[model samples]
Target chain A: MLFSLDPRISRLELPESAPAPPDKAALDQFPTYEVFHQRKENTAYVYVGPVHAPEADVAFLFGKEQFSRRFPCTGMWVVPTEAIRVTEYGDDQQSVYDRLPLLPADVLAATDAAVTEAYDIFHLKKRGKAHTHVGQVQATSPEAALQAAKAAFGDQRPVVNVWVIRSTDLLRSDEADRDMWTTTPDKKYREAIAYKVQDRIDRFKQEG
Target chain B: MYGSASTHDIPTQATTGLENEDPILLAEFEARIARGEKIEPTDWMPQLYRKQLTRMIEQHAHSEIIGSLPEGTWITRAPGFRRKMAQMAKVQDEVGHAQLLYSAAETLGKTREQMLSDLINGKSKYSNVFNYPTPTWADSNVISWLIDAGAIVNQMANAKGSYGPYCRALDRICAEEAFHLKYGHDAVVHMATGTPIQRKMMQEALNRWWPAIMTFFGPSDKMSTHTEILMRWKVKMATNDACRQQFLDMYVPKILEIGLTLPDANLRKNEDGVWEFSEPDWEDFKRVINGDGPCNAERIAVRRAAEENGAWVRRAMQQPKAQYVRPLA
Candidate 1:
């Protein structure tokens, strides 16, 4: 049996020796969801990172817990990785919109305002920086979304890349549930500032 | 809090295979890195860079998971409700760090499943200090304060590394680590200054852990083409010796201030401001890292059991159409 100082492990009665388990199947950890968070009210929803989850709801929960548990966050959004259309990365200090291929004349002409859906546009201001929500644009498709984003945000310099995701696909936190973001007063122990060891050390030194 | 400066079992003899890459693309890639631009997932990179980074980040991720085991065991038996809660929070953060790192590695083309498999099968390595048991609350405290202090030294350097995803993950991980370092310091100080028995236990634990902590950064790196290329790419960040020196420089005074003494007698700062200490047993470090450590079997068994037990839930929750895509930073 695997012995441990913690009786909890000893209780498990794990075998001392066992054959290595088989490798997990692909997607065993599930698909990825790109996460974005608002650090405070009236701030852009910036990309934090990605989380692996079974679905959008779980993704949102994981995103919130992973991205905002230690930091203050007022809002969160999680979208499936496959849903976000990404542009080629551009050089730092140069706008990626400059390299965007022109939308075909027929596609541009065929743009019907009534049929267009709302798409969220995100911009990478520089390489190694997180993408931030620039604005929303009405577009017929992901391709057109880039063009629409260009017309709206292309003038912004140092756009290293862009991500276009359908606004409907984003599983956003409900504004009514803002209480979830407020950390409890009892959890101060988890903050670095909560510990005061220097005082104790000083006392020991003084007494010695 | 466990991003080790050293990648255990680095294949120093392997050829870099740079000849196969297109000259123009290689030049551009090198130039981009030289210009201090971060390499994205879609960017063309040398085969060696991809392989080395995948291994390093994956190993760092495994360290976070395995490193938490020893500390997590202490949560149930922590001295008080506050300490227990803090311990629990720290363990949760470590596991969360593993999730973030796994996603970062996944962007390099490896699946999280494969990484976990490698960890259980002993194909990869975590920080070797965790392979030793934390026998007492004081032992666990040593880990919280000193082991984490060592890790912070390593991780702070790696946060400035070139990989976009790994750097991003480290930035977040480092932010959470501030609490861990302070909490650990607080825990150790509480024990060191508390009572006669408390001080003795803290001292004993420090004596037991000092060797493993010395080896935590791994052996001094031999300069070779392999190491040279990684440094130029900003992948290795700092040498193992440099990280160890920095750790000692920053933390040794703090440790001594609280009345705790490291077991090493030769450990001292020279007039040149360099630390000189007894050489850690690299042979023992190698042996333990290769699965002969005191707690290696137990750690792997526990991890493997958790994976097996949770398999059913994962299977149930998994969607047939779920497609994995590289994470966008």
Candidate 2:
């Protein structure tokens, strides 16, 4: 809900003059604008939260007051929330998104013959971190998607590098193919299994 | 502290059902916690875990918003430009904390609207210290210094909690609150060491707030329970008494160094190294938390009014085509 306080108890009164137009009071509420913050000039803008404002300038000011006042933010961008298009992968839709890496021969043949479109892809790399995307915006892009990606998934956190590629160039492993990447028997190569520094140090102390 | 450290009295019967959960599932959950793994939004958890977390986080969210009211009054009447801007920024931070907390609690299934409605209707409680009046500029400074100090102690412990979202939010909040503590201490120091009139006002404010500040960590551990399970769950990170002691250990010397005296004559550190003081009036603590404090009605009334006044703004922004999706932290 946009508002949590009950509106029924409001004491606002209407005038007794001729009835007003239906949309007369409609302009009071502003559009919900998404805020992105750039922590440093070298970093990309990351999506922070949304602010309601009638115009871009007002939204920038509100964003500063709401999100940037105490935090160290090098820059900020505000765009209306509607400007962005999102494709969400939810729990119930697993069957559609979760496919195995090995596909039918026809599908593989079709993939090789397909034309590619430049697309900006974003990644949520870490938990509790806000840098949403990693790929650079392709110069040949739809006006709306590029702007949305820049505003919504632009550099807001420190990223070492950015890569530009066509949408068709990206390859994703299907959920059914999890074991292909994860079923390695080389447990000793993983840090959690490999690093026993504490154990080693204790053994050394005991030997000494 | 924007969030209350008050312990809700949980009945013994509440844990009876919790004991009957599938043992195998419970063991795995406990093992994850024991290994310091964070429980995420999609994680499997016991019903009691969700219930306790919701209540604690919801109450904390309420505390932040309600906590804004007392010091918010000083934004306009602040003596100078610096104080005015700083006070405004600080109060805004508290409200932002509320927004963050409400969103965190929403991950557990309770909607922000329901939490806020509970707050307005007096079904939920906030920090007891906020229920007292901020009658003077000095009073605001005292709250900033002492109450926020107490919050830092409590919240820092909670930052290490097993809940991923709550811990992440607390990490960010504690960083901001550290700045608030400095801001508060700076303001208090100026008053305490200033002119005679300023000194007196500061002293009186400190005196008035001491009792409430003492109660900020809630009653002593002897009177509270249902905490063993919470501690294991990493929900209640520290006992009310433990937090209070830590606050005293960190702050008492600083308070004295500023030439300010605590109101309680019995307040002192014993040979055992624990800070000792006259037990705060538990009766008053109970009364205040039960919505019978000096400014409870006024605080809620102001909040209600603000909500009413802003209803049009909220109404104007509603879009029929837009769908509400919780933000990923």
Clash totals, every prediction: 0, 9
The digit string of per-residue lDDT tens for model 2 on A116-204 reads 35564444333334434455543333333334344555443332112222344323223463343332343222112232233433443
Q: RMSD for all candidates, in order, please.
A: 1.1, 14.1
C-alpha lDDT values of all predictions: 0.90, 0.66
lDDT of 1: 0.90
Grade the docking of candidate 1: high
**Candidates 1 onward: DockQ, in order:** 0.84, 0.05
Against the true structure, candidate 1 reaches a TM-score of 0.98
Give the B-chain TM-score of model 1: 0.98
Off by over 4 Å in 1: none
lDDT tens per residue, model 1, A1-208: 8888789999999999898888888888888999999998999999999998999999998998899888889999999999999999988889888888898888897886449999999999877779999999998999999998999988888899999999999999998999999875558999999998889998999998
Query: For this target, which candidate reaches the highest DockQ against the unseen true structure?
Result: 1
Residue B58 in candidate 2, Cα distance off native in Å: 1.8
Candidate 1 chain B weakest lDDT stretch, 10 residues = B320-329
